[model samples]
Target: AQSVAQPEDQVNVAEGNPLTVKCTYSVSGNPYLFWYVQYPNRGLQFLLKYITGDNLVKGSYGFEAEFNKSQTSFHLKKPSALVSDSALYFCAVRDIRSYIPTFGRGTSLIVHP
Candidate 1:
């Protein structure tokens, strides 16, 4: 089974400050981790993924995440937060053998200007 956990239901940050959304996962084999952001009434947009290379991975909208093998974690990060960055963020984990990925409940990121 593959599972992802977003511990916090919501995260608040000021504009221009760095922000993080915590995520953890469990899988049987190699884990493929992904981060996505959902705008209200819109579909989830792919942010980043940890597939093969370095533990530290960067992605769209200046987002990044570090994959910790030992902890089975993949927490998303942003150098600076924007009010526009406020959205629902989701963490997903997939087992290579599985066709579909399992997503977390999602974290609501609120960036105040």
Candidate 2:
């Protein structure tokens, strides 16, 4: 079975400050990791993904994630956060053998002014 955990229930940051949302995953075989952000009453929007290749992957809205195999982690990062960035963030992992993907509980980000 594959699973993903977003350790923090909420992450608070001031506008213009860097922010991070932590995620760790477990899988039996090679892992496919992804990050998504959701606004109020909106569906999840794709942020980034790590299937293979470089350790660092960049995505929409000035966000990026670093894939660490040894640590089983793929934490989302932004050099500077905006109030608009506040939303529900999710991490998902898919195993090559499985057709379905496992998603995290989601972490709420609050960007304060």
Candidate 3:
């Protein structure tokens, strides 16, 4: 079974500081990893993905993620944090043969101004 884990329930960072949200996964085969952000009362917004190619993948809103095959991890990172960046972040993983992706419990990012 494919599974994803976001170790921290919450991550706190000061505005303008770098930030990271951790994630790890377990899959039976090749894995497709994804990161998403959710605002209050809003749906999930795609952030970045790791399907192939470079280990570092960039995505919308200045967000990026690094895929590490050996560690089975795909942690999201931002060079700097903004108050507007505060939200719930989720990590998901899907096995190549599966149609559904397994999502983490989501980590709440609190960017203090």
For residues 38-99, write the lDDT of model 2, one tens digit per residue. Answer: 99999999999999999999999999999999999999999999999999999999997999
Q: In lDDT terms, how accurate is model 1?
A: 0.96
Q: What is the TM-score of each candidate against the true structure?
A: 0.98, 0.99, 0.99
Task: Assess the local accuracy of residue 6 in candidate 2 as a C-alpha lDDT between 0 and 100.
Answer: 96
Model 1: number of backbone collisions: 0
Q: What is the lDDT of residue 36 in candidate 1?
A: 94
Candidate 3 residue-wise lDDT, 3-98, digit = tens: 999999999999999999999999999999999999999999999999999999999999999999999999999999999999999999999999
- What residue runs in model 2 are displaced by over 4 Å at the alpha carbon? none
Scored against the true structure, residue 85 in model 2 reaches a CA lDDT of 97
Extract clashing residue pairs from model 1.
Answer: none
